[model samples]
Target chain A: MGEILVKEKEIVAPGDVLASGMDYIPTDGAFRDGENIVSSLLGLVYIKGRLIKVLPLNGVYIPKKDDVVIGRVSDMTYSSWFVDVGYAYDAVLSLKDASSDYIERGADLTTYFNIDDFIIAKVLKVNKSMAIDLTMKGPGLRKITRGTVITITPQKVPRVVGKMGSMVSLIKENTGCQIVAGQNGRIWINGTVPDMERLAVKAIKFIEQNAHKSGLTEMVKTMLSKEAKK
Target chain B: MSYNKRFDGRKFTETRPMKAKTGVVKNAVGSAMFQIGKTRAIAAVYGPRELHPKHLQDPSSGRLRCHYNMMAFSGSGDRVRPGPSRRSKEISYVTELALSPVLDLSAFPKTVVDVFIELVQTDAGTRCAGICAASMALADAGLKMKDLVCAVSVGLVGGTPVVDLNYEEEAYEEGAVDIPIAMTPRDGKFSLLQLDGDLSKEDFEKALALAKDACQKIYEVQKNALKERYVEDKK
Candidate 1:
């Protein structure tokens, strides 16, 4: 029982060669059998007649519970404010849950978080009700006043963050950027200057491409030091 | 008639057969029945337990799994071609995306909550129906959440924002366009938006406004269904 190789968005009209190497259908969906395939690894599935294929799950922000994500205050209500972390749901930072500090009656929580003010928080839960609650009570949860936030595959966030936060820590040490990791697969990399931001982005992307391998700390430290020199 | 109406003799913006039921499954931790007109979707929730394969187990933040499916005969004239279609798979993806913000996966480690959504009949807006049903199902499953998420698609036909479109209205070749939005009305935040086609930013804003209005009504329906289920459970 061998695997098959199906192309990405291959146009197979009629008796076209949908796959090669193996006669059997791939158990995984991104690539499929001659027919009747599902992109099992989270993506958009498109079908024509009986044949189906997939477009890989793109974008950096896929949703997950307890993912410490970063976002901006898009809108506010009496009870909660909508934090647009670029996931399907705008994370709700409720009045009671936003912080440890007591919010008095009629005290505009807006002072704490105004529209477009960036922030970092942890996802508490996603109910069948689809309500996303957030709390700023984690080691990295806080307000991101300024800098840059780059989106990457939520699946690759671990790689971007590196083992035990080594990769992120190095970037902070070298570039002086504050980074926040969201569980839903979003990262807020805030560097003081454009160059630092660029360096941070480059480092994150490096982790993304080579996340499967080991010894990423030395690799990232070397990469950032080299970029800083240039 | 001062204004024209649809096939069901309802105003363009008027919703159809909006009914909601809950507790359809006893085994499920939570469950809900959500319908927009004739389209019906059943959602159920389970877990907060060890996600096996074991290696994926994290000490912090439990895993979340979601499935959006349609019954074989969910459509009027067509037998639903099963086994995770792309549309349904995307539904599963967005369904997961729409809820992660509220799930609090960090509090529970090594546990996973699985949400399953099945459409018994689909006219239009099945994804939104599944999302709405799934949210209620989580509640029935006894999962804690900040609040409910209500999703609805408002299309623009004749440049007007029509709340909740049926299959015919959706497939119609002529007329204006529409957009789908998932939101939590209690807070003015959007969950999911599968808006395609073309529209000025203005039309897009109006569609969002219409979706917000529709979600408010949907929020009440979602609460009532959960309340009824809990009330019945006691009985």
Candidate 2:
């Protein structure tokens, strides 16, 4: 029988033997070498049934289809707009995907979306060369003009959003700030009181710094309350 | 007379004390510092982001570029030039070769992972120290790799095999042969091997065995350093 070598939630480095034998399956950041499952990244080990994978604590975001991302328009072509979505290559936003209204050919593209303007976009496709296609025609997808954008490590986004977005909802309910968190780690915060916006940003950063720790939800709530009082 | 006693009072199989730490540079995606005796090297990892110069990017796999530099006052010899010298350039090229075997950049096509290694102090084994630090930094950066690489210099000090030679022993008038070796400990594969002096085939084999053992010890230090980056935070 195959034997698992590492404990659940144990931190593993690259080349660390996670399991030995063919009975176990490896996925994600873990791979099979001969009969042994070896971790290919420095991260924590997670085992479910016979499937073992390592979840990374840090890394750049690779865009995926259907992921809602916050991007800034870097340039415009005659037919499409190039959005910088924190990837190696710029994502293309074609005119048809930009809006529901019919835009005439060669019409002023800047009037619809200009350079340096941020928008909430959805990834439509990613080709073999990592070329990305983005669309802004979706619910909650539009130009962002009235909020301050802040970024955290992409790996911490899941934690900042929390389980079913409980963490973000808590922050919103308490601080009365409108917050939108993109899977790419960019967050837009808009609030009536500048102080509350600042507090929400601080709470998000605190969640990022302590993302790996347990009891993080309580800690974030405590921090938000203390900071709001000042 | 043949060289017998080590000047520093270390055994033939003993290496100088080693110290290693990860995440030294706050701005870098990954960074580390490694010190072996008087030699110290710091490395920072960036990119796998975007590769500039449209022509150089490869569609199938990412590129690895290493820059090896010694601070102007870091050398025991005369002051180092501020810019890249021929020796530094060669070392940089070899450093890349030493690290590429374990690194898997297939997931990040058309990009580059840049490693910057700076020597803040020097004695001997600067390249080996640099390789160790760079390996840790790459791992800390969350890059996928087959295994970590460990390196050490093994040599014959006048017919006696030594695990890691210090600067004084390298300059021993009686004659010493320094052979720097880098290995992927798990696979027992050699990624780097360079000879600076001569030795008998028999002595070379013996020293190679010692070097392999020494590398295992260095590997332990590297593993501990990486784990400490997270483990220490638990306290």
Candidate 3:
């Protein structure tokens, strides 16, 4: 038998013991020491059955394979385009993986994706050396045009998307904005009226600042409605 | 312990006034400004993002780098030069070592976390104050750390060990020994220890004990600084 020390959604400091039992297993943001599972970060604790993990309140984004992300074109080489995906190493987007059309060797690569252009792409692969491979050929993957992009802490992206995307859908439906919430903490919002776009940004910021609070979805819904009428 | 009165007109174990706040720099991930008596230092933390110059990237875990500098007008008399000095380089290295133990580096692999500390005002014990500020900046950046690092300097003046020496006391003749120690307050384990001048074995032990006690008081202040920041933001 093991004892669980923290309540659900409670803020826990690093090195705080989350649980003690041989039957319990540690997950993300937690590590095992002897018979205890200790939190390794400042975060909110979530326990599911015997598996316990901590949700960090703040951190930079770490890209994973198959994640949809928004990146800016940083540099161009003979055969590849380096994308700044908010990570240490620029993700490589080779011409071959970029699109279905074959690009001629030595052809000006800027015509396809120029420097400082934002693109919504997918992570094709991440290697042992942390070399990331990206692709723009997938569905919903293309260059972003004429929309405002806002960056938030990547740890809050899940909250912005809400459970099953109910939160995002509410924002889109009320404001009539085409919003794409990237897992990398970059959001793309295009609205017919500039006020709507600004409203969406404000709502997203609210989510980022108050992600830990309960009843956030209801609060966001009320806020959006009040702003939409104005 | 026979010194009834000291240069600062305080008891031997007394410390200077401390004030600290986090999130001062808007651009950096986390930032803090700390002042102990007349000694003030500001620290900023960035990254867990990409580590540039790919060759320096560590494969197993994120690298922690610190830069400690003193501003030109921070000293008492002549203005210091604005550049990296040997003393600054050594302090930066020790500061990095002091903070590395508490961070969960493996969580952000193939990245780097940079902490920059600048001494805005110098009385004495600036490096120790810088260590304290850097720890708060790291926490304000929301990086996962096991425990906050708290530090204070203990020095021997007139054959008596004193806590938190001032500028004049630190420059005493008679071979005064200044020992600065940094540790994780929760566990009472020392992460950084440096000795300047000379002390006997028995005296060094006594100084260490005094420093450990002073660290506990400093830890309370550090904890309160962090809580105050978050509490205000909640409202």
Best by DockQ: 2
Q: What is the DockQ of each candidate?
A: 0.01, 0.76, 0.41
In TM-score terms, candidate 2 sits at 0.97
TM-score of chain A of each: 0.66, 0.97, 0.97
Model 3 iRMSD vs. native = 2.6
Q: Of models 2 and 3, which has the larger DockQ?
A: 2
Q: Which stretches of candidate 2 lie above 4 Å from their native place?
A: none
lDDT of 2 at B38: 96
Model 3: pairs clashing at backbone N, Cα or C within 3 Å: A88-B50
Backbone clashes under 3 angstroms, per model: 29, 0, 1
What lDDT does candidate 1 reach at residue A195? 83
* lDDT, residue B112, model 1: 74
Model 1 TM-score is 0.49
Model 1: lDDT to the true structure: 0.68
Candidate 2 backbone overlaps, count = 0
RMSD of each: 20.8, 1.4, 2.7
Best model number under TM-score: 2
Worst 10 residues of 2 chain A by lDDT: A55-64
Greater-TM-score candidate between 1 and 3: 3
Stretches of candidate 1 off by over 4 Å are: A1-230, B1-4, B232-235
